[model samples]
Target: DRYFPSSKLCSSCGSIKKDLKLKDRIYKCSCGLNINRDYNASINLSRYELAI
Candidate 1:
């Protein structure tokens, strides 16, 4: 089971979701950023790899 910490990734800005809620299916952030949960995770992971 590949689990992406959606609650830990910013759904709107693609940043790390520091204070995310499990109940949030759709990311409603003030930054006007919106995206799927998995997409954020993949992007995060990719960025992380590139940094290293």
Candidate 2:
């Protein structure tokens, strides 16, 4: 997942914001979803359900 931009991606709408910076703490999507960056990343990761 090193190459994946999980933080820059909108977990709600699946939209990618390539311009998102590391300093951005809030995750906002055009789909009317606004959440914390860490929370959003966890949500997106949970969706994958990867087997370890």
Clashes of each: 4, 0
Q: Which number leads on lDDT?
A: 2
Model 2: per-residue Cα lDDT at residue 37: 95
The lDDT of each candidate is 0.61, 0.81
lDDT at position 50, candidate 2 = 72
Writing each residue's lDDT as its tens digit, candidate 1 over 4-52 gives 4544666446556656666666665567777665666566677656766
Tens-digit lDDT string for candidate 2 (1-52): 5666677779889999888788989988889989999999888777755732
Model 1 regions more than 4 Å off: 1-7, 11-16
lDDT (Cα, 0-100) at 38 in candidate 1: 62
By TM-score, the best candidate is 2
